[model samples]
Target chain A: MDADVKQHQMKLIYDRYVRYLFIASACLMTIIILAIIIFVGQQGLRTFTEVSVSEFFFTTKWDPMEGQYGAASFIVGSLYVTLLAILLGAPLGLAGAVFMAKIAPSWLREIMRPATDLYVAIPSVVYGFVGLTIVVPFIRTQFNVSSGFGLLAAGFILAIMILPTIISISEDALRSVPRPLEEASLALGATRWQTIWKVLLPAALPGILTSIILAMARAIGETMAVQMVIGNTPQLAKSLFMPTSTLPSEIVVEMGNTPYGSAWGDSLFLMALVLLLISLGMILIIRRIAQRRLA
Target chain B: MSTGSRLISPKIQDKIATGIMWLAGMVIMGILVTFLFYMLYKGVPVLSWEFITGEPSDIRAGGGVGPQLFNSFYILTLSLLFSIPLAVGAGIYLAEYAGNNRLTDMIRLSTESLATVPSIVLGLFGMIIFVNMLGMGFSIIGGALTLMLLNLPVLVRVTEESIRTVPVHYREASLALGATKWQTIYRVVLPNALPGIMTGLTLTAGRALGETAILIFTAGTTVSRQLPDFDVTAAGETLAVHMWYVMAIGLVPDRIDIANGIGALLIITILIFNLMFTIPGKLLQRKMGSSRH
Candidate 1:
């Protein structure tokens, strides 16, 4: 009896220690996040000290070789591509979500659901390669452009890339709407189309909006695929057919070549900081909307 | 009433709406199918046993992706090795031990934010912190560490979810039988949650494999001409990076063919991983009767 009690006491101590250990492991994520923020912030802020913050952010010229380091054009390019993606993807994604949730037969759902998951699983680089070989060339030939890489090509790739996110999230949101609501609309003699637009979509509006915001976040941050198609010109895009660059793409193209402590490198870090803040804001907004829906 | 009748009937409107939705669904499916088959059709002509096993050549018309394929798996293993333990531990703490409190909320928020951070930004972070600060300079270790951060959020979320699905009675029974908390978790809870955890792991592995932006900066774009060495500090390019490099900068005569081959290979590998987890995931879900969203 005495030996058994002593073993049990030892197990209790071990459990307590392991529990704290797990907590420490959990805390590690917070530590890493803080470290990233601090390190990036420190590096990024150096750009401002070297050049005025307003000039760095507002200047359109980005020739780092001659010391022109404004990122206004990249920021605009990111927004333009992301906006185009949202315009092209959001409606189709919503319609597809509605079809899957309310209209599709079971057989079709099974096939399409797995396909969607696989779509998400495919690497972004593969998308880039496809865009580079197929879409860019096609655009060049079809439009008779000098170079095929442009905002339109990047936007098209992003549209397809974000389809899975938009579809899944919006489908989940639509599915979560109670069955009784739809039944009541039917009982009131509302048409299926009216029920969806007037009843179901409004109820799931928050979720749909959340998905849109999330998809927008993804499109803005997408680097490799966009870099492959967007001609990497650090200038304001003249038109849909013109080449442009984004913050992330610019960093990818220049980070390796730039000296570590140079103002150009610091500028890349600043771009990263900006990207980080935008995504964090989106995530927090998503959480807030989700929580409000739950409440 | 006849004169006031609308041009389009409500029934027609409903049909049109339904038709549009169906067409939208078809568009999505069509895009996916076209992407898959087009890639395969273009890539399969060049794919061969020799291509899979032979070393990449810069001068020759035909070079294999052997070094890149090996590097991909090598870095994947290294990252998983570094990430799984901490993610599992943190997951268990969140699911079992964390109560409704500010600290838990903060942790949850941090994980979500980590999940949303752009891969390119993470690439920049890795380049600065891992490559420069840690003095690991464009090596496998640096790449793996960056990927570990990227995959941890998903792994922890999956672990917590699976742990939650392990019926509370198992924990209570283990405790009632004189098992300590850790003992119950190890002997009782973890055993039952193994399938779910495995599913999470498979998914995380897939994410890590597909990652390019993070690996691009952390893992150098250059691949060893010879067979891959076991050294962690050696610079290596993954298959995805290889695909990018071949397309972006490769001046070889057969760059297009090689890029196509790499694309096809990547798609096939990803499809295999997806199927591997999904079929078993369905079976496990059915067996456990645990309906996960």
Candidate 2:
């Protein structure tokens, strides 16, 4: 009886320790996330109040050297590049996913899926290098320009970089399409392609959109590759061929030795904040959709 | 042929649609091929034993990525060491022990959400916490710890799924044979789950090897090309970071080649790591399928 009591006590201690560890670790993840938001928010807000609101918000000129900084141009650049990336990347990625999930032979699917997966494993830095050497030269020659680096070039590179993400996510969505749905479409004498389009595609639309939005989030926050190829000019451009700057790239360029003013720091912080908000919004939406589907 | 016969559309329309599909497939394949070809063309010339082993001399002129290479290996080794055991253990608890607890569900939700968090935010978080609050400064150790945080959720999710897939019968039989719970988990459950764990490790290692933004915030952008003094924490640049430094900051022609060499090396390393996961899983799956047949 005494031994049984001792064993029960020992089990209680073990249970308590494990439970506490789990709780502590889980709480730590939330704490880390909160701390980041607060720091970025605080620093980002400093720029808004310190700088003239008009100068920071309305003006297109971003001469950090002359200190007449406005993020209008950089913001435009990021948006333009991201839009271009989505335009080019989404179709290719979705098609590839569909082809793999629906049409490819077993051996082809086996080879292609891993091949696509390998692209994800390839570091962004390598992608940057490829863009610098191959894409840059191709753009220069094709456009007959001195500088091959521009918003369009950067967008193309980003599209390639993000392709794996879109492909994988959309593939999952496509796979979730009920087999019965496809079979029913086929029994109605629809062609394979038609069945895919009329039946599977509609069913998979939300998941595909979710993946595309996630890819967009990636493009918006992307720094190293976009920075490497975007020519680092903070000017609004009418054409896709023109040089550009992005918020993340600007933050990376300026944050190291930012002038000791809250305005500049806050502006950078605000950009981070915008990015944070975008990602948070995306996650919330994805979570809702996921919960609904899973539930 | 049956597909063609069933498609009783105007022959021209069917032909056109089929043609467009074929064209689209060709274009995508072309892209994949061209990307590979261009990378090899630009990146291969610089790949050499001397280049791989040499150190960065003048930031602008020329040197090998010896330091960055060491940093990559070091960070990969250390972060995996710290993260895998904890992640796998947590996964085991969730998959086997939790059994529908609300807390476990919360953990699952959080980890999935965590996977979607943009890496840059993770970088910013690491900077404030590790670099400033913890006073680790820009060092190898700092980067490794930061990486551990980024990788943990992914490891947990992958490990959990893989562990859950292990047959329940194995666990029940082990218990029925009078094995202790711990022994059952270790002997019966883990062995069956080894392939999946390795698969998860491969993916995690690939991400670790290729990770950049978080490292940039925590690990300073200094590339020391000499032989790595593993004893010192504050000394090296990772291969990915080295590529960025060479292009954006270093401003040297020779450094560009070295960077290219390192870029190629990094891609090859990751590709190999990816294969490690894929090939084994495939072999195992095939074996299982054929046995069932």
Q: Which one wins on lDDT?
A: 1
In candidate 2, position A259 carries an lDDT of 51
lDDT of 1 by residue, A59-106 (tens): 898888888888999999999999999999899999999999999999
DockQ (0 to 1) for model 1: 0.75
Query: Ten consecutive residues with minimal summed lDDT in candidate 2 chain B?
Result: B10-19
The sequence of per-residue lDDT tens digits that candidate 2 reaches over residues B1-293 is: 35755666635454565556555555666776676666666678988776787767654465777777888999889888888877777777777777577767667656655666666666666666777778877878888887887788888877778878877888999989866566677788887777777777887888789888778877878854446667436744788987888778886668667776777787778767876676887688568647745
lDDT for each residue of candidate 1 in B95-197, tens digit (9 for 90 to 100): 9999999999889988888888899888888888999999999998999999999889989998999999888887998999978889899999887888888
- With candidate 2 superimposed using the best TM-score fit, by how many Å does residue A11's alpha carbon deviate from the native? 6.1
On TM-score, the candidate that comes out on top is 1
**What digit string (tens of lDDT, one per residue) describes model 2 on residues A1-295?**
9998897677667756765564556545555556667877776777766567788767888765676768888778888888899999888888788877776677877777767766767777777777887788899999898888888888999998778888888888999898999999889877777777778888998889888888887888788788888888888877777777888888777776665344665577677777777777777787787777777
True contacts kept of 2: 0.29
Clashing pairs in 2: A44-A269, A44-A270, A47-A266, B56-B225, B60-B252
